[model samples]
Target: MNHYRQIAPRSKEAGGQLFAQFEGDDTIIVEATPPKWCDRRNRYNFHPSRWLQQQEIRKRYSCGLHFVGDWHTHPEAAPQPSQEDYRNMQDCFNKSIHDLNRFIMIIVGYAEAPEGLHVTLIGQNSVQLMFCENNL
Candidate 1:
C-alpha cells in the first residue's frame, strides 16, 4: 500500500482490490493488487477498470482468496473519501453478489502507515471507521 503512495511530484493515483481470508474471528487481508495499465490515473484521482478488477477477483477466488474490498491512493497526508469514492464503493457493494454484509475501502495517502491509511467498512446500512492495532 505504501509503495503506491503519490509521493513523487508526478505520481498519479494508483490502486487495486483487496483480498482476504477469514480465520476464526479474524479477517486477515492477504493481498492487494497493484494498479494496472488499464486503469485511468491522475494526480488527484484514480479510476480502475472494472473488467480487469473482475478478472482479478475470479483468479484470486480460484486461489482461495475472497474479494473483500477495494483500495486506492490519494495525494494528501491523511486521506478522506471523496464523494465519488463513496459512490463508487456503494455501487460496487450494492451490485456485487457476495455473502458478506459489508465491503472495506482503503485510501492510502502520502504519509506513512496508520496515519496515511483511511480504513472504512461500508455496509448496506452503515459505515464504520477502522483502526490498526500497531504501526505499519
Candidate 2:
C-alpha cells in the first residue's frame, strides 16, 4: 500500500489484479500484480492486456492461484468508489475467466506513508465491505 505513493504525485489512481487460491471453500488471497497504469488517469481500468498478463501469472503459479479480482489506490482519505468501479466489477463478474462466484476489490486510499485499505466482496446480488489500516 505504501508503494502507491510513488505515483500519488499525479493524483491518478494505480491499479492491478488480485491473485488467490482456495482451500476447501475458503479463498486465500496470496498475490497481486501491479502493471503499468494505462493512458487514462483518475480512474483504474483493468484493460485486456492486464487480464492477459494475469492469465500468465495464474499459469506461473500452475493454476493453483488465479485472478480473483482487482485493487486500486484512490486519492482520498476515505475512498468512495466511482460509477467506474461498479461498471468494472459488474463487467468482471460477467466475464472473469476464473471459477469465481464473487470478486474482491481492494481500494487503497491516499494518505501519509501508510494508507487505509478497503476490501469489498461483490457477488451477483450481494456486496460485503471490509476495511483495514495499512500499517506498512
Candidate 3:
C-alpha cells in the first residue's frame, strides 16, 4: 500500500504532458517522459527503456516504500495498457523481487476524445480493469 502511494504520482504524469493521478496512502511516485522524438519521421516514439529506467529510478529512490503500481498515456484518450504493456508488466514483475506485492498498469488512450484514462491491475497471471474514480 505504501509503495502504491509513492508510485501514484509517477503514473499521473507518466505520459509526457498528460497527467496521471493516484489516490491511496499518501505517497505517489511517477516515471514520465516527454513525447518521443523521431529523427526520420519527425514524430514521436514510445521508448520502453526510458520508461523502465524511470521506474527503476523511482524504486531506487523509494527503497522502503511499497511498489504499488504504474501507468502510461495515449495522446488522445485517457489511458490503457496494450499487449506490449502487459508484457512490460510481466517483465517488470519477473525481474523484481516484489512479486508478492500487487502491481497496477494504467494506459491512457485516445479512442473517442481527450482526457480519457483507463487503469488496470495485474497479479500473478490475472488482470483486472480498475476505475480511477473508484480508487479501489
| Superposed Cα deviation of residue 54, candidate 2 (Å) | 5.1
Q: Which model is ahead, 1 or 3, in terms of TM-score?
A: 1
User: For model 1, what is the alpha-carbon lDDT of residue 126?
Assistant: 72
Clashes of each: 0, 0, 27
- Using all chains and alpha carbons, the TM-scores for the candidates as numbered come to 0.93, 0.74, 0.50
Better of 1 and 2 by TM-score: 1
In the range 1-136, model 1's lDDT, one tens digit per residue, is 7898999999999999999999987889999999999799999988889999999999999999999899999998888888788888888999998988889999998988867888888877677778532324
* Candidate with more favorable, higher lDDT: 1 or 2: 1
Report how far off residue 35 is in candidate 2 (Å): 2.3
Q: Tally clashes: model 2.
A: 0
lDDT by residue (1-136, candidate 2, tens digit) is 4576334555566677777877888888888766564424454433436546555665856867777877887777656577778677867777655567789888777655334666788877767665545322
TM-score of 1: 0.93
- Which residue pairs in model 2 clash with each other? none
Model 1, runs deviating above 4 Å: 132-136
Write model 3 residue lDDT over 1-136, tens digit each, in one string.
Answer: 1121113323322333112234564335444333334211111224445555556546654654445555555443344456877877767666756534446665555343233556666676777776643343
